[model samples]
Target chain A: MSTTPAFKRLPRAVREQQMLDAAVRVFSRRGFHAASMDEIADDAGISKPMVYAYLGAKEEVFIACLHREGTRLMEAIAAVVDPDLPPDEQLWRGLRAFFGFVGAHRDGWAVLYRQARGEQPFAGQLAQMRTRMVEVVAGMLGRATAAEGREVPATELDVMAYALVGATESLADWLADHPEADPERTATRMMNVAWLGAAELLRGNTWHPSG
Target chain B: MSTTPAFKRLPRAVREQQMLDAAVRVFSRRGFHAASMDEIADDAGISKPMVYAYLGAKEEVFIACLHREGTRLMEAIAAVVDPDLPPDEQLWRGLRAFFGFVGAHRDGWAVLYRQARGEQPFAGQLAQMRTRMVEVVAGMLGRATAAEGREVPATELDVMAYALVGATESLADWLADHPEADPERTATRMMNVAWLGAAELLRGNTWHPSG
Candidate 1:
């Protein structure tokens, strides 16, 4: 063997991926500030400097984790939602995908939604992610309403989108505490709520006791 | 002059209350770890040792704030919820009170909900508050469904409560970002969703489109 170092490690790209996986697990548990680069490196079975070299600083690691997890979540919903399907079915598909994603990746959802809030440097980035999420729902809501020739005012549309997203996120946090609850059951329950909620709003149906 | 200081000069109870108020403000903004007892004492126009004397420690101060705010929020809701009112009206009343209180005492709500989540010693207390909230909604749901001669399944009731509470909390967060949104409007939108959503679920009326 040559005098130079003989035992080479994994490539930079693979190491970066490992570091991100470690970061997500750590960040989700400890939140951002409490989670350290050294812990992430130890979790990844690599040295701290090597992990830094692949993932930059701690903030970059967090951003990278969010980007990956966010993309995965968005794609999960997009994959389930077929434009060719009817509006209601499309909405159902999206809600199901969302609840399912949260059920499966509770940690990732927590890190993105709960842990990401309150911090300054990441707050803007979190806001951007939230905007992207709201836009996706708003687009779907607009399309669904338009397909029925119903015109939902822009402001109402925005409120509806926020309500839907908020309800789902809240359910996710509750689900985290109640792990005994089945994911399918949870998703169905949410789907029922979302479907009924969206339909009533779209048709301008108001709830009052029978008079 | 009396050797003892007059109540006007500063009673212990008054000083303690002042310290608690200052602690709430600082802890709400900077969270538990970031907030210092010195700053809290300064904010209260007292010395650091006094803060320690009244509150014991930083964590103790945070727990005290949580208990105080949690009690205030629960009391606000209880004060608004009239036992004699119809279930739907009772829910509407509760929602209005909730949104109104959140809008008015935002710092308290932030301390109770956001900052309290990260700290372990306080999470149990926060969960207690959450349980009380869920119980409030569950009681309403139970009463609403009682007239139909059948109880809503506890699981389903839990899910509905989560959705309503989640929507309200989410709306509160959204309202924080967009202050122009009127509290009345926010309350109305939330009530509309809750009352309508609850109605459909109670009737077992799933909103699936006709195939």
Candidate 2:
């Protein structure tokens, strides 16, 4: 019988990432309470103790997954946005990148938004992440309006940013159910609502900025 | 000492609703897997057998809760929208009702969106409810644009409806964090995005629609 040699061992950083990847997949599917470290270890093709050694507790593993996935999503959006582009164009690209990322990495998005946010124990941490994300989006909206040479109220911009983010998220949820739709298609749909509505706001339409 | 009845004598429909209300609260808080039937019974001020008899099984109880809550939400939206009013006015009323319902019944909203959508068996039902909601919004969009003598594509309207729904849901989640914010305020914030973006689309601004 011929014996296959074991794959070469990886460094702690690489192994930790591997564990996080597995945890994200499992947690996204089964949620926090239903997911077990043993299942995660099995998914990663690593032993149980090694998963602990690399990732600490289940909560820590979940946090690591959020960090990895959230950062990746932010970077994905950044890659698509161009500062020199027209304001509408920049917003369009960013929305497209966001839906694309969610479509391609559904598991990661689910881990960050659905699983982690649903866990009460992690609510404080999740709130911080949410605030940071909101700030990033608010910053983008501010930049876009500034490019248009319009002085949009920061509060109005903040509300718009929140609405834009929410719309993207709801569309993403819709897309998850109808998997046949392409990410670009989803992004385009979102852009129509976001950019057009945003333009109306900039034109000083009667749309009240309530919250 | 006077004693309350053992819950066995309660009418079936009344008892069922009571159990469902409890289930919604518990399920929303602890999620489906973590929420036990025993605790649900306790929350309902009843015994285990009474709960079981009133609502078939744990899953059945959850489904019952979802159906009831979803119906309540749809009704709220329906009640607020005036068909005779102009499209924009109708949309505003609907948005207000949605935000109002969610603000007052946060647990119901959580159960409908977060817990039910996250749990497996109930996910399909929630998906259907979500689709129905999008359809309603799309229908309204169709009427509004047509009344204004504009002809946006059905696909664009569908996407916009999705974004509108998303904006409402996102505001709902945000309200959980900022408890002091009123429903009217949240509704107004959503209307700013919806009406502005929607009016722009009717005017041929060509904001790229998402998938």
Candidate 3:
């Protein structure tokens, strides 16, 4: 073998990916506060200085991990959601893809998300991600309504999307906690809760308070 | 007047309440980390030492504020929710009470809850509160199903309740952000989203995957 190390030969992009993978594992295992740079570097088989040089710092590394994971999740859902299909079918596919992603990355979803949820800087990033999710859901709802030859106010669509996204997020938290839970079954459960009401709304039915 | 200060003449319960009121206002105005004991004491017209004696440290005071506010919120909802009423009506009343409370204390909801959500110790407290809310919602759902001479699995009820609570929390966040939104109208919108599907489920309808 050559004198040079194998890792040294890898491209910067590949090295960064390796660092992120290790960082995600460490963050998931030890949590945000307790996690250390040494562990991440050791896990990646890289020197601590090299890890820092490449990813800036632990905070930046965690953010990179979050961005990579979050982007993957969004892409997964988007890939399965076909606008050509009926809206309900599109929603079902999207949900399946979402739960499936969470199921596969349970540790990542639990620690990274729960830890970030309470921290200030990380929470802002999460809010931005949530806003993107809400927009996507609102767009889907708008398209669904348009297909029915009915027009709902954009604000109403936004509100409904917020409710759906919140409900799905709650269930994702539930799934993260319950390792034995089936992702597909969870998706079906969500569809039941989401679609029945949405279908009713699509038909122009609404609940009014009893005066 | 006597040499003893007016505040000293007040009973312990009254003094503690005053301290909490000031703490809530300070925490709301300055956020959890940025809030100071000096400001809270100044607002309460008490010395810093007296504020500390009454509520322990800053963290403890924040916890105290959270407990008081959370209890008041629960009480408000409990007072309006009559089990003898139909499930939908009970839900509507409960939602109205909840949104009304949030509307009235928009600052508290926006700051205290959001700040606590990202911190470790406070997040646990918030989780406990969420669990209580989920249990109450699950109980209501169970009773609703029982009244219809039908029974759903407790786990299913719990999942549905989580979704409902999550959705409501999301909307509460939305409402907090939108100062002009009407609480009662928000409650009505939630009812339309929640009850229509729940009514269908009560009538033995569920969504299944097409495959």
- TM-scores for chain A over all candidates: 0.86, 0.85, 0.92
- By lDDT, the best candidate is 3
Per-model fnat list: 0.44, 0.75, 0.63
**What is the DockQ (computed on Cα atoms) for candidate 3?**
0.71
Over B1-211, each residue of candidate 2 has an lDDT whose tens digit, in order, gives 3254667556655767778888888988787768899999999999988788668788888888888888998999988787777777788888888888888887667645666654455766876887888898899889887887887788777778888887877777776546677888778777777787777676667654332
Chain A TM-score of candidate 3 vs. true chain A:
0.92
Which is better, 2 or 3, measured by TM-score? 3
Q: What are the per-residue Cα lDDT tens digits for candidate 3 across B1-211?
A: 3465768767877889999989999998988878999999999999999998778999999999999999999999999998899999999999999999999999989888888875778888998999999999999999989988998999899889988888898888888989999999989888888889878887889988777
Model 1, B1-211: lDDT tens digits are 3354665546877777888899988887776668898889889999998788777899898888888877887888899888778887788778777788788877667655666654465666876787778778877887778777777788788888888777777777777656577776777887666667677877777665343
Using lDDT as the measure, name the better of candidate 1 and candidate 2. 2
Model 3 in CAPRI terms: which quality? medium
Candidate 2: tens digits of C-alpha lDDT, residues A1-211: 3142445334656777878888988987788778899999999999999888777888888877877877887898888777777677777788778888888887667545755554455655665765676777788778876766778878777777778877887887767656677988787778777777777777666565332
Docking class of 2: acceptable
Q: Using TM-score as the measure, which candidate wins? A: 3
Alpha-carbon DockQ of candidate 2: 0.44
TM-scores, all models, native as reference: 0.84, 0.77, 0.93
**Could you give the DockQ of candidate 1?**
0.41
Alpha-carbon runs more than 4 Å astray in model 2: A1-10, A22-43, A56-62, A78-90, A110-113, A122-127, A142-155, A175-182, A208-211, B1-11, B19-43, B56-60, B82-85, B110-112, B145-154, B208-211
